[model samples]
Target: MKELTPVTIRPPFARYAHGVEIPAHWRIVQTSGQLGIRADDSIPEDAYAQAVICFEALSEILKSAGMTANDVAHISAYVTARDHMAGYMRARDTFMAHATRVPSSTLLIVSGFTRPEFKVEVEVLAAAP
Candidate 1:
């Protein structure tokens, strides 16, 4: 399996890479959008708590695919409230603390989610060597 490379253009961009190159033989795993529902099927009231749960769910999906956060190539985050951005970033950074490489990321602030209680949703794409 070939290694994944993060590409940056001549001009400096944002904190994330402009693009990422996945090797030909590597397996890709794309996860469905994850919400902040806990094991007891309870949703958190605050954005920060919800964001942490969402990231945890994403991590579990990556583990099931035989990948870790380091293998993540891209991430998409959807938040219901713009004010929740800081909380979401904290959750994401905590989860990615051990990441070998940072993945390209996109954040969208939408009106609401399928369930109004859910303030954040996260989806991920990972590549396995």
Candidate 2:
């Protein structure tokens, strides 16, 4: 994979690339948006905690496909409000800490989720050869 940061454009606002180029013949996997809910039917009130759960769930999904964060091509994350941005970013950074390459990322502030207690939701697109 190649990070596509053109000289003419401004650098990414965070620890991610403006774009990524996946090689031909690589297999791609996309995940549905994961909420912060746990299997035990527990949900955290904090955005960071919720985001962490979402990432962990995503990791499991990746593993099932024989891939990892290193193979991720893009990330799409959503939060309920503006205040959750910091927590979401922190969780996202920690999740990608071991990634071999930076991937494209998008963060959006939405009105809300299915459950009012839900503070964060995340999904990813990954590619592997």
Candidate 3:
């Protein structure tokens, strides 16, 4: 009797992959740390607002890199106000909702930022297929 093959067997398909492997090669792109400066070089006065601004800027950079928030592998957030931690997280969640996968992140509270008017700054690393 001849062996029969399984009719349900199918090859896997990659979709929205975070990375792709090639023969003896890998292309990687690392972006410069982005900040919350508007086209006119204006920054928001509030920390939460500044965080939003930073996220917006980072989003654009990520898009340009052939990725989105879902591709973000890690992130670092700096804040000057410790009491406003809740507000900062709220903003983060809002921004992350647009992503396919929520990336790991770190948050730090500092006494001051480079600009007195700026409240928060965020840096991110992303990879995509």
Candidate 4:
């Protein structure tokens, strides 16, 4: 497998890369929507805490796939309320601080989740060589 490359268009879009080019033979690992629930099935109260937990869960999934946050090519984040957007962004930035390349991302403010307690849910797509 070859290394992944981040694509940047002429006109700047956002902080994240416009797209990622994955080389042939690379394996793609797509994770399910990860919530803030802990191992004991307990969820945090605040949006920030929930966002952190969600990212941690995503990290665990990537690790299981022999990948790291740096291998992530795209990310989709969902929040229950609009007011929680800032906190969610902070948590996401913190979680991705050490990444070599930031992934293309999408953020949405949704009405609710499967569980009422869940304030944040994150899904990630990773490319592994």
Q: What is the clash count for each candidate, in the order shown?
A: 0, 0, 1, 0
Evaluated at residue 3, the lDDT of candidate 3 is 19
Arrange candidates by TM-score, highest first: which order? 2, 1, 4, 3
* Candidate achieving higher lDDT, 1 or 3: 1
TM-score, per-candidate, Cα-based: 0.88, 0.98, 0.70, 0.87
lDDT of each: 0.83, 0.95, 0.63, 0.84
User: Which pairs, if any, clash in model 4?
Assistant: none
**Candidate 1, TM-score vs. the true structure?**
0.88
Q: Give one digit per residue, the lDDT tens place, for model 3 in 1-129.
A: 111223465422311222222223323345565555788998866667767777788888877877777666666777778865665677777777777555555678877767677667788766654
Ranking by lDDT: 2, 4, 1, 3
Winning model by lDDT: 2
For model 1, how many clashes?
0
- lDDT for 68 in candidate 3 is 72
Q: Identify the superior model by TM-score, candidate 2 or candidate 3.
A: 2
Highest TM-score scorer = 2
Candidate 4 C-alpha lDDT tens digits along 1-129: 222333443633444665667778899999999898899988889999999988898888899889988898888999989988888889888888998877878899999998899899999888988
Please write out the lDDT profile of model 1 over residues 29-102, one tens digit for every residue. 99999898999999989888998998888888888888888888888999988899889888988888898777
Q: How many backbone clashes does candidate 3 have?
A: 1
Superposed model 1: Cα runs more than 4 Å off:
1-14
